[model samples]
Target: MNDKLDLKSTDITSLNIEKIAALFPNCVTETAEGKRIDFDLLKQELSTEIVEGNKERYRLEWPGKREAIVTANLPTTKTLRPVREDSVDFDTTENLYIEGDNLEVLKILQESYLGKIKMIYIDPPYNTGKDFVYKDNFAKAGNEELLESGQKDEYNQKLVVNPETSGRYHSDWLSMMYPRLKLARNLLTEDGVIFISIDDNEVHNLRKICDEIFGEGNFVANIVWQKKYGPANDAQGMSDTHEHIILYAKNISFWNPILLKRDEKQLAAYKNPDNDPRGVWRASDLSVRTFSENCYFPITGPNGQIHWPPESTSWRISETKFNELLNDNRITFGVAGTARPMQKKFLTEVKDGITPQTWWHREFAADTKIARYEMKDLIPENVFDTPKPSLLIKRCIEISSREGLILDFFSGSATTAHAVMQLNAEDGGNRKYIMVQVPELTTEKSQANKVGYKNICEIGKERIRRAAQKIKESLNQDSQDGKGLNQDSQDLFNLGNQENQANPGSDNVQANPGSNIDLGFRVYRLDSSNMQEVYYKPQEYNQATLDLFADNVKPDRTAEDLLTQIMLDWGLPLSLKIERKTIAGKEVFSVAGDSLYACFDHELDEAFAKEIAKEKPLRIVFRDNGFKDDTAKENVRQLLKQLSPQTEMRVV
Candidate 1:
């Protein structure tokens, strides 16, 4: 049996390169020091034609381009620290709210969420010169660099301003975003898509990098969203009234965006003028710009007037098709029956909804003003400066994802979370979200501080709480008015129940049968690994120091910390339900309801292990130092194997 502990976290980028090497051995070559990619060989293997070095290519480059690549490939010795007190319904919620530097968070999430995210919508720093862009120090370790920077407040996050006057202004911002985006792409499913909110300041640069990362062919659309209603009369040149939302897919061939629901105004155009049995209908043009010899013939109107195709235009269909449509009463003329011929399009014959347009209007999508008002309504005393309206995010969610996982790493003010809840309530979807944000401190003189919000994360968590309460209240009101949970809601509620039964001890709070909304999220903060550095680098420790180190785990680390680290190592979702149960008076954590059972209590005996084995957990873990002696440890392992032969066991 393997007795030594494995405290190292997974190196995600290296694993990716290893996967590539597995597929193409020739493309992977080793240097004198370590394994590295043979790019020339890789390019030759991938293409029929080859291009030599120093040749002009269609690509984007910056001052720190190479350094940015190095930053992304470097693995970090960090872990997510669960904070139960900072969370709402930490044990039961499917959602996640991570308070940390998003870059590190993305790296930590690589294992558990790889290729699982359905959609990602990030509103990162617009690079408008005033936004704080993270500065990663590649020379030093992440924890060491963070501590030395003195940027960690109570939240342990560092934020630095990237002003336009700086020599490497654009390079700094690009470097900050490059690695994060690269990591985020790894978490997207094959059919997944990402939407990034940006302004004119860096939209061009953002698109170039996204093309490089997600591939140019996967470019979906650059939606122009009208964010302002009235113009800024006092402008430098032009009044900026819109922002761009750049979209890209993991694989364009596998992605198909959902259609948006048609508004009442669009539906109003269709009318049952003739009381047609097919239903409401609208008149469509019967001519097109293309010239077709078969469709050049003229047609006689109801009043015996000759109707020819407009100048340089031809009939939309062939003569045979037109005759068939006319025979079926699908063609129409004006009310007087003397106007030009037209085609009647019945509402039922068309799609259930309208195709999403590239241009989003302010009315339906909601404007910045409305977004401000929403924040005001939630926390009347204070409001975020530029929160995206929930409706805008709702539209993105509806288009990009249905009932799958959504993520927003730059989830300022938690508008994305609020939008997810609101949309779930509206469509009865069980879509979950993961929100990550640095606890950027609020200015002391700002309204947020005056209202008791110390950081951006505080505002975000509160927003989710208030948003959920509002949704529940609305649902209750609807129920009292004779409109109870819809069929979709009931179905979702049943699904939740089934999951709950499958994982018996996972959920502490069960969902009410009448309500099918999940409005809570677990909270996890970024921190150093649970194990002490000396555990991994034992050569740095002297014999005397090693002898004194009975336990590899840090003195301040708790059982929960060890459990979360194990979860990460096992590639388990951080939001998985965890339950604390007692076995032989010793507290055992039942993760995801027997998926994993662990006990960190010291001086553990064989009887406790056997009692836990009786449950037949899929996996079990114990602290190495928890046992009284070597004999106790061997006895517990033998008993567990005899009782639960299938259970995989490990130790911290």
Candidate 2:
């Protein structure tokens, strides 16, 4: 995986560090706070030296627009910590469900997921004047300012408020979304596309910023989706029945939407009324709107009636083609034998699919009513307001990806994940998803709180678990009763309510295994770096701080936490298959089968290094204090070199 890395300018700070490390590996040493450059050692190595975005994004500027730019460029010391208790198939699942502020989460995933995501769909808050809790101000001067300013959620994170009465109502919402989108663009593949769902509140403003961020040429469409089946009887104003979904691609030239497959209702239009041996066919108008003197010929129907093109219109085909069609019995007349000639469109002669239109009806894309039904089917309580139907999101998935990575940063009830699972089950595809949601606390007076769902994340995770159970049960019932639901697995989107349903286990794809309809997702909560304390100066520092860090790595942090940090630092995906083993009285984690190896135990010797090097892993990482002394650290590296010169080793 680490063969000649691509020289792309992404995550500037980290990539430059890697380049420096390559040229002077000794200068790049691990500290308690993760990797750090050893300046003194680097000075020796150089004696000589070391070698190591967007334009006019402000087309329509808001109050906090500059702060939004600063936020996107800022570095985060935070890292994702694994939550095994809340996870399904922790070490095996390829799907990810992360709980954190999406802005920070986007920044953290930049390196690992950069330009890898195929499609992104976010249904963010509509800025409807509600008193929505917001993040700490990016432009605020200091922590004291935040402490004097906003409310802290259950997790103790500072949160401000945005209300209709506030002066910066629309500006606040735009600021919140700007940075997130800026970072998200980097995570998309060249052929990637993003769909954002918004209502009238900020749709116009959203378009302006999106045009600046994604570029005007990348603009695809502003689909008008029917969100309601009927109008509200209450006479407040014209009842709002529709919302907009804006589509944009990473590069317009590199991508195109997949045509929608013809459904049963559309296909039913065709029938073999004449019992033609060719196939079932439907009558199509054969007149052209534009005037063409050469195509103004009349046609003789099979019923011995003469037919002419409609008034002001000409025949679509030339006289020669019309004669050929007449000879082949491809023209049709009215059942009464007095109508004009029409062309017969055989089902077998047309394309298998139809191009999608900008207009989406509720029949194909479920409305708000069905969305509530789906939420009730799983939680049976009003945990979310204005939830989107899983089928609605499934429509987006169908248009976006057939088998690729899908991301949903504003995953409220996790409808995107639900849709992905249903689509994969139906087609036997190997699509994977990553859902990120902030653990927004439920108000004490809310139904979700009364039902014991403390936060939105709790509800989201529960929905995925129950949805998986529902899919698995459906598959099983089909196998037993032979109802053939497996072929029509999209029915799973219905996700019906069942009384006394037990939460069931899920399946995993491992990080590196062959893809499947993976039912499980790994859980990770964002937290500060695992480093307890780090030392800087080489001899004046290395030994003591390294020893202190090894002896204690954040009392609250576990070995898995350390492993995850290492994964991020190394640019290895956190989903890689990991195997835990104890060797020479030390705990070693084997990641992706010899791609990398790590041991954190104290007193590591040459023998232990030799044993591990026997397999010749691509890289090895060890805790600095894992060895007896400075002498022992050098000895282990030397031992590994003698045994497996192909292996790269590092000490933290």
Candidate 3:
């Protein structure tokens, strides 16, 4: 109970080494630095043929590729702290809006959301020379170092605009996308897919890396979307009117796309002029392109006019089948009953819905113009230069998944969150979302700053709030007007009818039927670890003073901050609703009934222990040095073991 918690993200390099060592122990060798794999032995184990390093192999590589991979594998000490004032329903909302560098945020989410995300849609920077790409880490350089390096200022900033004239423009952009994509792959479910919106600027490069990250075989389709209705006057050779959406599933074999409902235009193709009992139908050619001995017979219309097949063509069915269909009134001719025979195709007989095509016009998916208008409607300013329309994201949501967790790391204006809420109201599906955006500051001269939006996160959070309210109002009006949800409410799945349970890390929100729309979202900001570091030496400090008896937590941190770190360290979801209670003078935090219990308050004695043990939570934790002495800690541990043997107790 007195031991400290592991307050760091998972180290992927070490985890991979462990996995390899388990398979071939002999291949793993201990070095002065650390344990590493013997390439010769690993090659022999993997292949039956001789391995050669000079062999040519097809692959995409560039400067910083190795560094990007290393960056993805490295662990971080950063942690997310709750921002209650910025959140809506801080304790209950399954949705999340995180403000931080997405790379660090992705690492933090690795444990709690691994293989849990069902869909991802990110509209990342297109790297058009003007857009700033993440520079990864910012190093504060000294004046001498800056002078030696011929740089203007101290350590490079986190985001730097990449001009086309720069030597490594393309390489820099690729490196930035590589690590983020690599980490993102770990969060997608087996049947999940990612939809990335990109223009011609980096669409090809994006596809190449996507092939490397998500298997090439899993490449689904490249949808060409019409984003513009007309051409701009300042055109360079030709005006760009479309963009591409690259789709890739984690496992192509497991991919199951939800078919789109037929629109009015598609339905207009089917009609019944003669009023058939089987409902509206369309006529199909009764002739076959290939000649068949059994299907070459002629047919007589209702007016007793003999009809022959087109030149070199034959009847689609045999004489016996044609007679059977004729008896059932499945064959149709001209209204005058003097034309070639045709088969009646009933609209109700279709078992498969409309399969989406690779081409999407602005009418169906919406355009960037509509996106800007949407933001202006809520913000009343051109603060955000680029904002994807909620309908566009909703299209991706409907096709990729009907419910479950959705993620958008490059959540520019939180259009993904708005779409999730809007879709939930329309279909009554409890689809939770997590929007990760870097809190890059708005320009001082921009309208956003004048309106009090300090950063991009401020704009995003406000958009989500306003979008939620508008959606609720729209739903209310629709219900009152006797028009509940739109016709598409008949989507394949509606999770609101049953209990939705989250798993592995117990991030459960217990979303069930008859609940109001989950318009609320919890907000968390990334920051340094809450633990305080003690720098001491044998000559400077006594061993007794620096022992385990002392409190190592930073004074400024609250119990909630410590609990947030503890939750991440213990693989608990931050979205879980924490119920606070004072059990025998100590504030106890309970999550999901008896799933977890934590008391960060000081002086946790037998009274608090007994009260908590009665519930016998699955897991329990206490703050280090919270007891009077070692004896009290041991006694509480033993007492809990005797009373609640199944509970796993620890301290942080």
- My TM-score estimates for the predictions, one after another, are 0.85, 0.83, 0.80
What stretches of model 1 exceed 4 Å from their correct place?
Answer: 1-54, 141-152, 482-515
Candidate rank order under TM-score:
1, 2, 3
Q: Pick the lDDT winner.
A: 1
Q: Give the per-residue Cα lDDT of candidate 2 at 610.
A: 76
Error of 2 at 20 (Å): 59
| lDDT tens per residue, model 1, 1-652 | 9999798899786787789899898776444334567777778778888757456677886667788888888787789888889788888898999988888889889899999999999999878788888878768745787786557666666677777756466677888899999999999999999999999988999999999999999999999998877689997899999999999999999998898776557788999878889999999999999888888889998899999999998998988999999999998987789878999999999998888889987655767766776777778875589899887898899988779899999999999999888777777678999999998988889989988998899999999998888778767766666443232233333343342332111111122336577888898888888988777899999989988888889999999989998998888998788999999888899989889998999888888877888899999999988998999999999998999999998988
* TM-score between candidate 1 and the true structure: 0.85
Residues 86-194, candidate 2, lDDT per residue (tens digit)?
9998777889999988888898898889899999999987788874545646555445555744545444444466677564677778888899999999999999999
- Model 3: per-residue lDDT, tens digit, 40-89? 77887899897875455698866677878998998987788889999998
Better of 1 and 2 by lDDT: 1
Which structure among the candidates has the greatest TM-score? 1
User: Candidate 1 lDDT (Cα, whole model)?
Assistant: 0.83
Which pairs clash in model 1? none
